[model samples]
Target: MPAMRFFVFALSLAVTSPLLAEEAKPGSPPPERIVEQKIPPLTPPDHELDLLFAQLKKERNPQAARLIADRITSSLFYSGSATVDMLMGNARKATEEKRFGAALDFLDQITLLAPGYAEGWNARASLHYQMGNFPKAMADTAHVLKLEPRHLGALSGLAAVLSQSGRDQQALAALEAYLDRYPADRDAQKRAIDLMIKLDGQRT
Candidate 1:
């Protein structure tokens, strides 16, 4: 499969500030440690899945929603561009509903259907990271880097996953690589700096 590129450049990390590297204040525990959590895949494509998509699009009528989404998917599957977008849309809807497992499944489908689409892999990586599956997330990010060497999103994702996984040095390196390519990425740069300090303090 082709490398998956990240959408880091398109993401707004400012929405959530990065945690600094300082020691936790007195009486406070360190940041919560995240571990990989295995999630079972949802049932294969069905009328209910189509209805869910339609409901997400503001369609109130269940019957109509299922019909429309099914029709769209039928035509979308054969076209790479459309298929990617369709799958992405479904993933987004699943995420909005806090259905992380389903979102991952949708992303998985995207990768299977359109392995060459950098965006598909990137999206999958994001979902995996959100689920605390750092190893899987990192692997997907690497795939993105292979497809687009300068993908800021993948670089940032790699950095985040590495930091969380206790591979701070590697994370710092990935972040530095991203900053070198995007000098104006103040948010990402700040995150990298904060994570570096945090990791360094751990060593000291």
Candidate 2:
């Protein structure tokens, strides 16, 4: 059977363990320690993003709320070029077909052509994750964050990779970051709660 990339968790960091490096903080001593510190639980710190998410949460119907959020999310994926759009469409079809190698080929072209586009980086990140190439996926995720720090999708993808890689605490923080922007993601909420329970158990 072909290998499958598994994504079962959410984005984040600034943890207190020696396992993963702490998130860089202002004047953080080299290799800062945050061991035993609880993960920070702040929402996505962007006013515009908060407002959009607020609007999404206020919708009465669940599907409607998802639709609104989807629309908002969709807008983030657009890259205003027909060629890039065509390449991206092809990449999407390849991914759906499980032709991962082909999908990666297309994604490579996308990043090559639109190095500044966050969607290209995000797409590549996702494809790498599906291939179970966590380090490469993470490198792309970093690029996405650099290009668009408000990208919850990228953050969520990062969290999934972290969680599956056995970095539960890092996964918890990343999920919190994702939920800060998308509190309506029920699956993520459940996973975050589960991680909290598991982490708590380890403490005693």
Candidate 3:
């Protein structure tokens, strides 16, 4: 099998451990620790998303496309409720602190409080992915897509889940769809190409 590149949300950190790094033993080297942190993106005005999406579709410049995609992502985080936003912030902080359970709790409240908010589902999906709960991550991703079919993060996430499950064909299709919406995503484009080659080789 070809090496697969996993995708995570730009706004999220990829946490590999739920515990803090242990102190180095006497005369031993310190353990290397990887910590992932998430920076909450600003929520752009609702009226600007349409224009931003349009620009994203037509943007060929990598830098410009990234800017447009960031703007679109920002809008996705808008829940229109202060309470939900606060809960989401707490979830982010919890995740950063490696308090996965507490993060999940905050995420659960956010999802329940704003079931219509796609970001709530998206956030939970990211946490699940980080926790190696692919099934739950995929389920939350499905909810995100149902709420917002054009969600770039959800599309990429679905591809990641499918790829992890050994469903390369489905992953390729999902990634292609993501590229169709955001062509300037170089990483997704590369993954899509890799999948195409792998599948084509299987046909021979």
Candidate 4:
């Protein structure tokens, strides 16, 4: 009976102790509040662009490819920021004017402000290629592909740079990768055919 009474008392104390929290001291600071950040979902691209790519792949016509590629490029420029868009436009204008230095400056600003934007890197890559900076161009082209795997422009750029460097094997690999994503690409098919011939001849 005594042991049972002691057990009962202990159980009551255990249950009640949590309810009897110590009061904060008058001079003590208030408890800190926690905040949670909610990230928004990515927006989808225009369906028309998707359809255009599908058509472009099947047709393999240079004019069709150009139209679809332009649309795809336009779609990729959407960074959800107007400032980034403005900078991109400025960069394009400078590039057209052959002011590679000024174009690169604008692209640098866009990439710095929106590191996630693939177009900025892609634009820089074009400028680098124009200046015969093949290595830099390849690096940026790689980054653009990473940021947007569907960027046909970057894939083609990569293929061109690899070929220009006399790396036929690497060039073939790049074009093959592009074809994997776009099997009906006529230009890549032609390039691949030429590269295969070159590589096979070297083998003997």
Task: Quantify all predictions' global Cα lDDT against the true fold.
Answer: 0.64, 0.74, 0.80, 0.72
* lDDT digits (tens) for residues 1-204 of candidate 4: 232332232123210122333567999886464344433212235576568667666755566666666776677766776787788889999999999899999999987877777878888988999999998888788777666666777777877887998988777776776675566667788999999999999999
Q: What tens digits encode model 2's per-residue C-alpha lDDT throughout 1-204?
A: 010112222122213333556577898677645346443321233465567677765665556767767866776666666778899999999999999999999999989977877888889999999898998998898777766665778878887888888988877877777666666778878999999999999998
| Candidate 2 TM-score, C-alpha based | 0.71
Off by over 4 Å in 4: 1-70
Candidate 3 per-residue lDDT, tens place, 84-110, comes to 889999999999999999999999988
Task: Evaluate model 3: give its lDDT.
Answer: 0.80
Cα displacement (Å) at residue 22, model 3: 60
- TM-scores of the models, in the order given: 0.58, 0.71, 0.76, 0.69
Off by over 4 Å in 3: 1-47
Error of 1 at 194 (Å): 2.7
Q: How do these models rank on lDDT, best leading? A: 3, 2, 4, 1
Candidate that beats the other on lDDT, 1 or 3, i.e. the better one: 3
Runs in model 2 deviating more than 4 A are: 1-54, 57-64
For this target, which candidate reaches the highest TM-score against the unseen true structure? 3
Per-model root-mean-square deviation over C-alphas: 23.5, 17.0, 17.5, 20.1
**Comparing 3 and 4 by TM-score, which wins?**
3
